[model samples]
Target: MPVPDPEVRVTAVDPHVSLRTQEGARATPPRLRDVVMAYVGLTKPRIIELLLLTTVPVMFLAQRGVPPLGLVVATVVGGTLSAGSANALNCVYDADIDERMRRTRRRALPRHLVSQRAALVFGLMLGVVSTVMLGLLVNWLSAGLALAANVFYVVGYTMILKRRTTQNIVWGGAAGCFPALIGWTAVTGELAWAPVVLFLVVFFWTPPHFWALAIRYREDYAAAEVPMLPVVAGARTVARQITGYSYVMVATSLLLWPVAGTGWFYPTVAVVLGAAFLVESHLLLRRAAVSDDVVDLKPMRLFHWSNMYLSLLFVGVALDPLLTR
Candidate 1:
């Protein structure tokens, strides 16, 4: 049975008492540390880490060696705030369905650790601060791009696309790609084909990365009425799409080698990493071919590997300039 929204009260034997009223009466005020952690949780730090991973490496590549220490620090700080703002706003909008989904039920809003209004205000504040910081410390172009990405993730992905379509993560995921552009522009103060190539690489990588997790949480999304690809489509179909996008992502990663005119080290690393990514994606397809069950599918294997693949691949990106020099 589906869980009822928390706002709805269940009647008790006395009729005058309710489950929520009793629970509220029993609840104690949250401790200071717990309150601080709850606000931090709204930012989704792990996701921000991944965004920054793509960021700093591109800055290295753009510089063709070490980027200035001050610029790197400023860009990272501004990027963190910008990404945090988008995520916090996303939590505010998704709080209703988040309560119904098992995977997201423990988030701050669903757990009632923070009020919706407080989260909304906090998100807006972060965005404004990040934009101003980036404009002043980094560059106005980087700030503008970061602000655009923040708006797109919150308004475009979270509000418009997520609940409405199966292709939600495909287009919505573009917001995550901005860090590449931001990283490059922070170094050069302008856009170029090299960063755009990295942008496309992340673009194609998002679906496969996110869908693998969605496959694991298919039931939760169904319960929440979100139309993630795994929820509406068959396991085999979703796996096939994952495989297809994996090929394109690998191809795009290679484009950076030529577009940036990097040394042989980058392409060699890209090839090895791309091969492993393909193998894992195909393994998921093979598993889906046999059984539709989540247990049998073991989609998390690909999910976990995808994280390493992107991280190591970008590590190669950062290493190439130094090694070649």
Candidate 2:
């Protein structure tokens, strides 16, 4: 049987009342801690961390050194809330497919720990508060970018593109690039060639990064009828597309050196990181080319490595400004 709904959603439940069953029998109330954890999970904190990783380094570089502590704090808080809003809204929208997929079945909406109504309210509140905070405390430019990202993620990606095409993540991923732009604008109060290149880097990087994971969980997407690339294409085709995007991603990273006029530190790190990323992509491609079955793909190897590559590349980006001084 499905878990019975509480009189109030998990996030708003009264402390003293136990959750009741559908049959009207008394059930033990979930601890406040569990309810809190469920709410946090709705925001997809791990993804927010990755998004913010790209965010701060760009701010550091834009400042040409350290940014103001107050501005940084305000931007980080606003960015966190904005990202949380986008992610929470995604959960609310995708709750149907999420329940069908093994990976996302435990999310708050699917488990009924958070009602759709509560989730929608939480996301909207965060988005409004984040935009207002950034506009007043940081800058209107950053606030605008944050609001735009929320709209793209909620309306453009989650609502329209996601279920309609195998290329869902490709264009939808554009929304994720806003943080780099927002970070740059927060400091300079305008756009520039440097942040534009960073935006492109993320845009190209997203497909390979996400597609590798999609390859690993192809069946989950298939079962959910989400039509992710790996679900619709053969292993070789998916791997080839991943390799193509990986090439563009690395080439784009190299362009940042010449265009941004960064020091040897960033170029050197990019070369080493790009080489490792390419090597993994090639290995996955070779496996897919030789194997008749998707089982031989080992796409997760590249998926895990992609995470490390982005982390390392951005770490280099963060250090370049300070070291070049």
Candidate 3:
């Protein structure tokens, strides 16, 4: 008070100025809508949608017609939560690599919109809630299967296999196959050969389906140091592998018809769809063989078609029972 220090000199605050505003600028709290959307983005909703497509159709197949609306709803809800948990945990674990990849750089964690600790807690919460909800509303078997899938995806795939092996998605993909079993058990309370066949269908389908996307992002994967097939193998080699797996996937799909005792309609659809899938895969192989260029490879064509292939194939599964009935 005796003398003002030159370094510490300050101007008097205006009486009209609010004390909060006078305390230096504070960051605007994130908008509520933005916060909600960020959390939803963390769950990777589109992947969950694809997983549910596999799930509900199997429930319909298991019931051999329309399942109870309540049971269907509960199973779907639990499955979504479980898948979300797995995906969120995956995003958290992969955040470091994600920031390095152009395709994944925009995700919440990489963008700094959400903290890793918060995401981890959210993922674990979803897993617990899904398990409890399924056990209470559906059946314990389904709940157990969902929990197993979550563990396999988070621990088996994300942590253990993703970065270390080119064959990572091949075996780790079994996590996705669990939905077929979960859907079947939700209705029948036991596993069967039919769902097992469908499980194999998805298991074989995984490599080709994911490798196509990897073809498009080979550089991103190389930059991230991941050993995806495309990152380590020549385009022709990856394409050949894709075509081979496509053959196995189609063959496995047909097994479901005989194993589940489905009628003419299901097999007919399976044949048509399988033929189309084979054609597309072979086209991808031909393209890769002829050209090393990603643009010429046109990998996304197969990527997009694979999504439709699985969705429509499962659609066939759902409609088979109702149509045959």
Candidate 4:
């Protein structure tokens, strides 16, 4: 049985007096709290934090472990705001699919915490403000790269590739990789191979990191028709891909020493840490071989550790110059 729609009733208390009433009238109107949470969801603070973590280290390495304080701060702030804006725009584009996924159902647009129009407006405003701040406070090169990254993520990746193919993250990873180059350019006012190496590191690292996550939430992705690597390629394929990329990441980390000119601490740490990363990747590969497997929690653990790995690895770069000297 279906529930009835609200019924309107009118009654006359007296010959000339009339009263009208409606059921289900405004049960708890929208509140300021909901609006604020929507803004937070728009920003994607966790993603911004991770992106800026990659950004700031490039600044330090660009200036040889000593970037100008103002430039560093500006780069981080502008990068964070710009990345946040890009994420919000992505939310706007993916709202329909997000509503279908349990993981994303509570998001601002999906939950009606914020309207699509409001999100678009806020995203664009943040982007413009961030671009201006970066140009005025940082450098034109950094600003340009930041703008490009935002455009790539919102338009090229989120709007198009995401729905079209599983390689979305492979190409889209380029957007996040830009922060490393942007950070380097912020301090040096030019490009070089060092940041490029860092960019490659993150670019290759992205697939495994995201695939691991997608593996954990496979059903959600399947339900949403997201076309993630795990959905298109299958778990076994994704695991092998993770292992292969882990090897590439390790090999690339070793090259940073000569290319980026870091101290002994880096290679020593790189060899040890890189080996551990490989071990984790192999574990994921082994676990993914089973048929009808739902999710690999262990690989998810590795995915989390992989994030910590990159952060600590970059920190090694900053500390190497001091520790070795």
Using lDDT as the measure, which candidate wins?
Answer: 1
TM-score of each candidate structure, all chains considered together: 0.93, 0.91, 0.91, 0.89
Write model 4 residue lDDT over 1-325, tens digit each, in one string.
Answer: 0000001121222222111121123367669987898898778777777777888777777676677788888888888888878888888888887666656655778667688999999999989989999999988888898999899888888878877898987887778788888988899889999888988888888888788877777666787787888887777888888889889988988889999778788889888888888988887777777653754336667778788888888787667766775
Model 3 TM-score is: 0.91
- The C-alpha stretches of model 2 lying farther than 4 A from their native spots are 1-26, 292-295
Q: Count the backbone clashes (under 3 Å) in each candidate.
A: 0, 0, 0, 0
lDDT measured at residue 128 in model 2 versus the true structure, 0 to 100:
93
CA RMSD of each candidate after superposition: 5.9, 6.9, 12.6, 10.8
Any runs in candidate 3 off by more than 4 Å, and if so which? 1-27
Q: CA shift at 251, candidate 1, in angstroms? A: 0.7
Identify the superior model by lDDT, candidate 1 or candidate 2. Answer: 1
Worst 10 residues of 1 by lDDT: 1-10
How do the residues 172-238 of candidate 3 rate in per-residue lDDT, one tens digit apiece?
Answer: 8889888889899999999999999998998898888888988887887898899999999999999
Q: Is candidate 1 or candidate 2 better by TM-score?
A: 1
**Of the candidates numbered 2 and 4, which has the greater TM-score value?**
2
Q: Name the weakest run of 10 consecutive residues (lDDT summed) in model 2.
A: 1-10
The residue-level lDDT of candidate 2 at 66 comes to 92
